[model samples]
Target: MASALQYIEETIICAEILRLMPRFLALLLRALIKRCLRSHEAIYVTLLPVADQRCLERDTRNLGHDLPKHADCIQWIMESSSRKAPWSGKRVVHELMAIWFGSVHALTTTVTFAIHDLCLHPEYTEPLRAELEAQYIQFLKSGRGLPLLDSFIKDSSRLTLVESSILLSLSAK
Candidate 1:
């Protein structure tokens, strides 16, 4: 049997026609919108009937009315993708859902506990704040090339889990 990663690669490489069509339409719509925007025309355009056209319209209207031009450009780049090759829409959605769940839960729990710990350990507040400031200075000096800051942030994340059992386990022989 193929490994899980291999199976995933194969599935993405052979995505169905129905799965591929919407993504292609989305890309075309995005390109047309971009062209319209650059030509000083209205951002709204009639999109091909697809499930995601409403989403596209909402995003475009919000961009034209509310978001700054630079932000809208960034959003367009982030959201649009070309579908020249097969990619399983179902698999992409599943992966995104998993990441959203993991990040949201982990970040929320970590921040909650960090605040609680800081409140309980008031004596450490000045020192911790000083450390943060020192790191910020170092980041500024190095043009933000601060691996140590990243390490510290990651360590802080590990130390403040919602439950001890949520930590990863290591097996010893």
Candidate 2:
């Protein structure tokens, strides 16, 4: 049997690993999607021209060049103690680890529970599928409306009980 300290250490390590895993999986999936999209070069080119062109431009300007430097500066301040100056790498890594922890824990638990509920609720599956299909048709017909789909998603998420911890954490934060 493990000692108490050993058990606690193991638990912490396990939690850290769990936190890191989803970030890794997301990175992998994003790369895979990018690769798949690149493979369909013509389709991408045709759609790229008109697909929320301003939104794309805004994201490009706001996201990459501006955000990371500001985040790094804040991270540096957070990592610095009064007595000692902060190292940049340590600050950046610490902030990244915090982000990984928050995103992975919440997203993994929510998605896992959602999948499990969908698997268990065989009777509701067809109706839910039909509802989604009908919603898509309605969305195409109307300029904007996501009522049925949004409600279904919200209800499913509520029933899953996955967001409780996330809500608590957000409140604490």
Best by lDDT: 2
TM-score of 1: 0.34
Segments in model 2 whose C-alpha atoms lie over 4 Å from true places: 1-92, 104-108, 137-173
List model 1 lDDT by residue over 1-173, tens digit each.
Answer: 12322322222222222234466674464454334332111111111122134344445665675533333422343245343432233323333333433454556556656666667767667776776666877667776644543554465667654332211110000
Residue 42, candidate 1: C-alpha displacement in angstroms? 32
Compared with the true structure, all predictions reach lDDT values of: 0.40, 0.45
lDDT of model 1, residue 34:
37
RMSD from true fold, candidate 1: 18.7
Residue-level lDDT for 64 in candidate 2: 62
The total of clashing pairs for model 2 equals 0
- Each model's TM-score, in the order given? 0.34, 0.34
Please estimate how well model 2 matches the true structure, expressed as its whole-model Cα lDDT: 0.45
- Residue 24 displacement (Å), model 2: 32
lDDT of 1 at 17: 20
Q: Poorest 10 consecutive residues of model 2 by lDDT?
A: 1-10
